[model samples]
Target: MRSRSTLLDGRCTISRCLPLSLYRARTTRPLENHHGQTPVRKRLNSDMPASTVSSRHFYQNETLLDFVARSSRPVSLRQLAFFGMKLTNDKIIQSANFVRQELPTRMAHRIHDMQSLPYSIVRNNHISYVYELYYHSFNTIRRFPVIKTVDDNDRFCDVLRELLAHHTAVIPHLVMGVIECSDLIDSKRMDNFMESMLRSRISRRVFTEQHIALTDAFLKDPNFKPTEQVGQVFFQCSAADVVRQCDTLARSLTQSSHEGIPIPELVFEGDVNTKFACVASHLRYMVGEILRNTFEASAERYQAMGNPPAPVLVTIIDAPQHVTFRFSDRAGGIPPEIIPYLWSFVKGPRSMIRHHNFKQVPVLEAIVEELETFVAVARGQRKRISSLTSLTTRSPTLRLGMGLPMCKIYAEFWGGKIAVKSIEGFGCDVFLHISKLGNESRFVQMNNI
Candidate 1:
């Protein structure tokens, strides 16, 4: 192998004793031979292990950061130097540029495309870029002398905004999309007529299909007796089961809705159900909203591509230590510019804010009529419209900006926290963490839905 200098602790020196395997690794660039195949370059890290890549867990529990982290694996200096030289390959560089350009185009062609352009690459690319950036940041940028400035804070904010626009937006979207998708799939829509429809449902087939005892509990307990006495109900949903269901639904929907877009990848650690083991109706609604946004976003991307909806992956970690969830997507990741204000209802990209999906409606008259009705309602309470009835009739559009905030509130209320991360041109990840139920197991538990 040819001799070369290696950078160690910010210093460089020629070293001949460096491992030859490292040189061989460098010679190949990306160490393709180590695994006997071209390493997959992932754009995002779904909340599962990379070894568990599957279309079933496509978007449910993935994040762009995980992809970045996985991509940043340590390698020998010879490999790094060789890879750096290989990066000069027109084809390698072109592939990167191709992603940068094609992603934005795909995004712009769809609503909220700006948010999904980043998380498309496979894992290796994500890590490589992160590693390269780390090297550059330390060896190049850090070497510059620092100077204090009165406007430093403001400057930082600008940089932060820029970074978010360029890096973090998709992370949360991936997270939000995954958890929400799983939860939504797990949700069984029970309408007002459900009771009347199921009144005669005590067939032997039903008994054989489900846990009869659990069914009896729901039928007997006033809390879930399908009566008016139940103000609001709560339940626990299994994360793994939810992932399985979402996969089924996404596949069904994709086959029926659009042509066929490839689904995103998903990966995660631990368990999802153990976090939100017990769930409330409000939390379900919140989860629905988040999933609705995710689905809508994915659907829009599919439409833009003139392809069908793709598969999605959702993971719920029912870990004993911390119950968590991961959501990932194949539509790349969110744009960096919108990360800070992603859930803030602040103005989005001008193109999105001005693009009215309901453009055909007469806005002026509609607003005036809406305001007049609002004032009329505010002046007095109506006796006829029950709160529940009104809630159903007046439910806000699922795409409204309230989803994340509502999810945060519900997650926090349930003794958990939510977080997100993304890669600029790859994908995104969202994580929800809740206090674990110490020594608790739902293995034999049955949900009396």
Candidate 2:
């Protein structure tokens, strides 16, 4: 027996000067075919079973469990059917739900603690510890060995679903990270958080790709076919349709905001064959966001100067590996100093629009309903297993300050990027790229910026 030691992290019965063996791993011991009389036991010689085989390998804190139990925090997977929820994707909700069901109570409690961590602790180095611990948990879950029984195989598949859900969780955590950093006194650690966000984005993109490949490999067995896409699949997406939606959304929003101002005309420049191989929803959101920014800025600027807004130019360049969209607006260039803050998530006193409800969404209800229809239709390609009723979608609204940042995130998630160039005294040129081929696994990935 080893003498116990103590730290702020809690109790461990190993001394610092002890041999490495004192921290050694455990061997797996399983009972088999015990007919209530005498059980047959087997000692499996595998190194991973100690950490990976057990579902409770990650929890080191008990208070977290208490928090979840008290708050009833693990939301049911089925409840996502209602609209107004954070994510619209059904497959992701299913994955999250499966994890909620399968999560060991102790670990779930620990996760609740982490999830409930005050922004103050999460913004600093403290959050890294949580991520490091859970990274191991995620690693184990993803690498869980397949068992022979059908029930066992299904459990393995559930871990894959949870892993996907975990991928979706990355965005919220990073958002928390940035918000906390932005709240820092006098921007002391703001740069560090910014850098961390970029690194996290790249790392998440790579990890998502790898995990998808691993999951797809695991589910290749005939008995374990998962209907949802295990990876990204490509198809022809209509550029014209995306543009049309953007135009309509922009015009409608402009008219509403500017008291019937004429919306800037959009001139397309691209191949007659506007069919591009890309993800449809990503293109739609990005294009809509770009157009909205331009239309709003141009309309506001023209209204101030008593002149008709100039037509916004839309240029689409179809490259082999990617598609680029260039949107130029006549909003007189963005202020030089403000250009730097464009990418940051900082929301000053007047930064965000104050909207009490969904009714204030910028786009028309008819258009919002139509877009929802498109999403419903697109979701069919992925065999949706189950989902809660979606919260009714908010009418599409152009949110202040969020449009560019969110557009950037959506674009980058698919191995794409966005850049804005301002003429300082003229207009701003926003260039957005959509990757023709992205690792399907990284579909929900987002950038730190």
Candidate 3:
């Protein structure tokens, strides 16, 4: 039995105040705010039973449960392009409706997952902010009327545009929350939560951006012809070309960061003209991150050893069902200490260092490109550029240790994979396998929560 003063004091932590089981019990009272007032609760949907509501988590609502009960519709590259080719008013409305219904489902699952986290983690200010953001977005989207007319769709798009902008800060805030709660949760649990959150986020963005692109295309020209690209999906994305472009950008960025350091040359090999059907921006980010790592490592190694930097070998292999990009670097391979946690988002010895540095730029404006830039391109102001190029231009040395994990997520999103083979004292090889079939569905791991 804790005293009122003890419970309301800011010095008391959730875990310190109550046992985990009791904290999670349905009968637990809602936590009081600094003003010692119970938060106002929304009216539960008439269909929902009182037993289903938990006072411990205020955001658990009927809309969230309804959406969470439904499964998400997955789209492939071919399916996405096929729908966008001959867009009409009806098709636009159909697309708008899909987005309207799908977004809330995805957001609901995320919020549910957040609610399922430990009470101590949920109490984190950053995590609480994210939870509120999702809840707000989820409610706002679910309340929107079904799209029937073009005017309705226009209004829906406006809402999406605003939500998308608001979500630009989600990644950074989530990262900070995890960092702050690192001691409260195990590495595996944190990784699983972050992975599920990010993958779902990617899926949501894909659906939203694709529909927006389709609407913009139809508005620009009623008789618009679909070429290689239909929104984010590219029917014949050039792998070798993306590599060369990323190489150039990575070299320039590395040189800028490590001034006067000898940067390694990228030696292209194998199929240099390989083309495939995939999302070009996702591929660009993976390749650019790999190239940047190799270049920076090679430069540092050579400079320290008083020797010239060695060239990096990039081999592109195009198979019948898949495309593979292999990046071989001679720079001293990944340090053995951090290799085990290479693909972890919140683990490893450098996590604290990364946390300290990330605090300097608390809010990451964008993961790939700013929303303004993406919207500008959609509005036909400028041609679309590589995501990595845009990101590096904004922050050349933006290394928060999320590159590899994010790359892995992007690869797995489309049923592809990323792997690394490292020799502690010699060199390393990074393999990026992409599904060329364009029929494989998005890879969504089940949330343990």
What RMSD value applies to candidate 3? 7.8
True lDDT of residue 153, candidate 2:
40
Estimate the TM-score of every prediction. Answer: 0.34, 0.51, 0.82
lDDT of 3 by residue, 1-449 (tens): 66535533433444345433444535545444343423223221112222222233444355567888988776666667688878889999999998898888888889888767765576677777777667667867877877899988987776787666566557777888798887777879889999898888887877787888788888889788888888777888899888887787677677767889888888889998988877777787888888888987888797779678778899999887779999998898999999988998787888887777666553453343432243344345674543222321234565688888989988887778999999976789999998765434333332211
Estimate every model's Cα lDDT from 0 to 1.
Answer: 0.32, 0.46, 0.72
Best by TM-score: 3
* Tens-digit per-residue lDDT, 7-72, candidate 1: 222122112222343323122233332323222222122223322211212232222222222311
| Residue-pair clashes per candidate | 67, 15, 0
Clashes of 1: 67
TM-score of 2: 0.51
Which stretches of candidate 3 lie above 4 Å from their native place?
1-60, 362-394, 439-449
lDDT ranking, best first: 3, 2, 1
- Residue 146's lDDT within candidate 3 is 77
True lDDT of residue 192, candidate 1: 15
Better of 1 and 2 by TM-score: 2
Sorted on TM-score, highest at the top, how do the candidates line up?
Answer: 3, 2, 1
